[model samples]
Target: MKQPLADAPASDAGRLQVPTAVLPLAFGVLGLVVAGAALALWVIPAVPRLTIIGDELVGLSYIVAGTIAWLRRPSNRIGPAITGAGITWFIGDFVFVPNAVITALAYALMWLPNLFAAFILLSYPTGRFFSPAARALFLTAVAVSAAQYAVRLFVLDATGDYGCTCRNPFAVLPNVALYDVVMLVTRIVVVLITLVTLVLIVQRWRHASPAGRRQLAPVLFAGAVGLAAFAADITAYNLTKASADAGALGVASVTGTLLVLARTAVPLGLLFGLVRTRLDRALVAQLIVQLGQAPSPERVDEVLAATLHDQTLRVIYWSPAARAYLDGRGRLVEPSAGEGRAIRLVERDGSPLAAIDHDAVLTDDPELLTSVTAALALAVDRGRLETMVRAQAEDSRSFPTGRVTLLYSDIEGSTALLDRLGPRYADLLAEQRRILRGITREHGGREIDSRADEFFAVFPMGSTPLAAAVAIQRRLRDHEWPEGATVKVRIGLHTGEPEIGDEGYVGMDVHFVARLGSAGHGGQILVSQAARDANAGELDHDDLPADFPPPRLAK
Candidate 1:
């Protein structure tokens, strides 16, 4: 059976274990249902019609905004906070109930949504309160809100003209003066906290990068408008003091409407910001193309850096054998600590393939990182394979020795060629080595040793060693030499049952082959009688030129 592509999102979805859209959808539907019920039962029946409408609308706004944010960015906490605020605001409508118990419960919980909203604002963009001052302010807001709710539930009378018509079932002592004093203190604290939050938001905005500023602009404007409207409504309500005057009522009604509408702006602004932005599809496409081209580790890093627009991005492979992270050069890599860098681990089938070290800002768009990583999964796995091959090759080089036919070759006049070509000699020397290695490998030869312009290779019995030598000589003769340099090598072959040991063929046969190569002239092949005899039937007379001499004994 054909397997599904491992990198495809559908195939990888099982790894995450949760559908991204499900939770947000569930919460959104629940919030809307609760908001609808609250509007029907509480807002329409309230005495101050405009205030009730404003409050319900603000609650609805939070629901809509929260749902959008949640659906768009399920990993972020902002969505849940806003959504919870909407649900809690709707629950606060229970205060309009005629039952004493319900009214008391509702009154106790009425301020909870505002507390949630304050927290959401303080932790905008990152969803977590990252600063000490921000955390302190959030804790203070929680305490003040809780104190106000407690005072209202236990000390104040609920059956007053203040708001609720139901009696306070939880009230212990009805102290109107004490209630007023507590309420005043709570309001003062709220005002101070609000001011501080605004200041913090401004500071964050000013210090943010251009991209960060674009994300903050909408939320900041909406928050400022909401705060201004809320303050105006509070002032207007205090001034009216339940007056029957038309002008006072009108002012209260207008301010109340504005406040409710402004409250919605907060979520609306966030939703707008999210809607306007999306992951870079072009970068993703480019990355897919680059990865498909069989990229090296360095090339993979370059592509990721270009795609993410972070020049400092690094690709580190996880070496299971070494049990450590390694860079492209096979050197151990220690990721920097507290450098505002993020490590994104890429795994295949629960086993790690590699990790990307990149800027922390990339975490904000986790989907992008995930997409790019998925695209590079195959490349990363290939890197693992290459690393393993290199490790095995190194191990082989450390202990390679076997009883087989060995061939050694050296440039006849390499020193003179280097002096003749000067700086340009290196290029010709490299080309010579490449051609020799390629021909040797093609003839079933395993390279056991290599030095500047010299090669030691082992091959199975037969004409392969002799055939490879002939091919190398012919290539050198037909090729165009550099302007002031020529490439020529002397080849020697011997058949022996030498002991394979660390540092390769170590017995007399190996030394004998080296001596045979040293005795040959440029473009000459000197094979020992044993090698010639082993490949006797396979050797072609026409393959060897008349000018070339036969095998000679190595004393």
Candidate 2:
């Protein structure tokens, strides 16, 4: 069995219970606090008006969205990555630092948020990269970004460079031509990688399943829009710088604002996808309702199949007595995971009750399965009990006994019927056994032994056994059987003090009961004199034929 994601106790509504919602809650609080601090930076006289406001909004949006995602799915790494990007975006504003060392450090780390955004786009839905190609692209993006920053820091001094007034304290070898060439090449490489990443995202979306598509749609939409806006922002800024014209500057400003607004959709889309991709609570509710009314194993399977939307789903119970898995019919079943199918073990109180075999897609949302199983724990436990009962019946056992009456019965023409019916006879036989067991239990008798089409039961001294025999006769006579097959049973009753051990009644009385049952014709019930005496006044003498013969002892 797979362990739950969180160790917190289960809730009444089956949400992911946590020890406290504090940790992620604190992350959200701190993110907002940092965003507020950045807002203060926006009001500082040294920062550019458009740059400060745009940075603040973009950073705040990512922080808030990241906070929501992290709180919703704390185990996922994507949330923290996004939140880190937002924090770094805010920190990058330290390019306004008066201290030369701090300004240089800030410039080196300023472009990191872009690299983070690239990783986020390449690894949507699942927080991890699924293919080597994706990993390579992510690594390339990081490498190119680092190279660009390094060249800008050492070869191109920021003092009186690129319209920056801050001195480049970390500049070692000033080579303006080399710096521009390296920066241009890195930018071109980064653009190509971004295009490749976009293509990969499209391919993944095309190959995704219906459920997968639902999860990817929002994030993909947001990412594409953000990328487009980013490209436009870069184009406009370059055009404005090259032209030195008022109209170009106006276009750059408009594009920059649009870029900030467009980037907001990326985090919003991720948050939307996370919130939307949840197991339908209604399905779990319906399951709880169905289970409340004593559903059979088949009904349980149907409910689960509908709930999980996997029609091929199967519920196999673990029989502790048999030490194996069994189907609903109590027949042995071997469950293995393969071929786009998987099995999840359902447990209660740390003991295995059953296994749910379902589509492998469900593995993406294991918490849903865990919650559903917790809710269905009672039904699963009941199924375990039913499985044990059915297994015991199929593999009948003997028990210790004292003074009691024994009844042995067999279907008269079972062998011939089986020959005629072939495999269909199994169903008929199962029904017959069911009827017999029901009648036995009704008459206060215990079925101690059963094999093939035969049953051996013990009852207390009373007319109950006689009544059960007659009831079985009438039921078999009137019941509608398959293929117009007639069902007839021969029962033998004997009263004696039999010494029953682990293997059941062991004395001559048991053999005597078998012999008496074998001698009787179809639909006949033969009783020993001892049974007749024991039931004396309770036995309806009128029901017995007047010409019935006296009991004979077995040699």
Candidate 3:
């Protein structure tokens, strides 16, 4: 007993236990019909035993399937309509035992309506071949062919002319040529269409997933049996005379039962496809890798290259020293085509690193970006801490004083330089310190680091503040600069600052010195009024010059 391949609806599985119970019911019907039809076909002239019962049984299938559609797929209008029509017509096939041509014509008319019903069944995509249209067309063709039989039945009844012992009611229809041609053409068309339908069914069957095919298997098998039975019945009908149509009715009945099995396969297969979640793990892992925390450069690169090698993405890093993106060799690099996603990798010490290319979507994932951003932040914080510790040790130093002329030096573009240098900006300030040491020593003074980018110095007690100021300007003007950069220095001086002791942190001497040096400018110097008073002997004014490093700076 082969089962009717049909599946229950999603809601039905949850709401009611009886929804899919029809499958087993259909299987039971199949077993009974198959067994009963088998027996009926063994005996000749036993058409009644097969036709009437088999037609009703096949029609019952439409009812069950239609009822399922009505309950489970209310949105699908055609399925229920076709099912109902099939039910009504198949019921007519049983009740009206019409012997007259007119009655036979009416009987055939009843099946035509079911063809429309079968057409409606096509809309439901369950594993079964729910094509009500084929049935509708088949019924239409059946009716047209029956017209010839009806005419013969009428002629026999009216004239008592049931010609020949082997009387075919259809044999007497006028110039049989037209009818034969029409019938032949219709069969040809139908056969061609069926072939095409078979191809579609096979393709669909093949493409379905393993689970889908399995669930669809019974339905496909049943459908194949039904189609095979139908083909057999037709072949038998064509190969023999109508009076010799001995096994035709029985064969037709068998085909009908098999059809119930075939069409039901669709719904069954669909149900199975839904229940089995295939490749779900693979999908999840792919999504996690795409949206998870980015690993190191190598890992990130692999992900980028592997994930979206087909897409365009390119990233650029900022270079402050060169004022552009720098490559591995510290040279400017250009973008290339087919770059999937671009990510800039910046060197921790303000050097520009390589650009990363990957799939843009991976970069777009907010989670991935946030994780990378957080990691960058931590790296930057650590670098800054290191900078502060080194700056403290390297910038601070000892100095002596006895009315020594105090000088404070600061880089003119320090803030902008820091921003441009990024994490490595702290280290560049060391160069500024070295430059300040040379500048003060040339002017006969000792210098100490006051801060990261600021230097403190003092001339011999009698040296002019103006002289110290001139020295800074001259040093900056003469100092060698890296290509594309100008090293600008600004100094402030106060002559009265005189604190000399081992306590190096802070003092009134350092305080006043700070106030004077705090002033900012590039290649511009400020000398306090006290520094000018101390420089009177060295200046040209009879009483005292108002400038230190008097004439040289004034010039």
Tell how far residue 130 is off in model 1, in angstroms: 1.3
lDDT of 3 at 521: 55
Off by over 4 Å in 3: 1-47, 88-96, 99-102, 110-122, 126-175, 208-221, 241-555
The C-alpha local distance difference test score for the whole of candidate 2 amounts to 0.70
Residues 115-220 of candidate 2: C-alpha lDDT, one tens digit per residue? 7788788776557885789999999988898897898678767643122456677789888788878876776676677678778888987876555566568878
* Alpha-carbon lDDT, every model: 0.71, 0.70, 0.46
* Ranking of all predicted structures according to lDDT, beginning with the best and ending with the worst: 1, 2, 3
Model 1, position 512: C-alpha lDDT score: 89
TM-score of each: 0.56, 0.61, 0.32
**Model 3 per-residue lDDT tens digits across residues 1-555:** 111123467886576656444544454455345334334433434234554554445555455555554444444453455355434544333212324443344432433432442343232333123345544544554555465344433332222111113333433544455645554565454454445445555765776544334434533554554445444444444444231112234545454555444544433432332333223223334634442442322343444333333223333333443345433222345544243333435344443333444333333222333334334434433434433453355345555545667777777787887776666564456444544554455456665545667777667664455754664465455433335455566667776645555444256656765655555456656667877777665533233223443312221
Judged by whole-model lDDT over C-alpha atoms, candidate 1 comes out at 0.71
Model 3 clash tally?
Answer: 29
**Separate clash counts for every candidate:** 1, 0, 29
Worst 10 residues of 3 by lDDT: 156-165
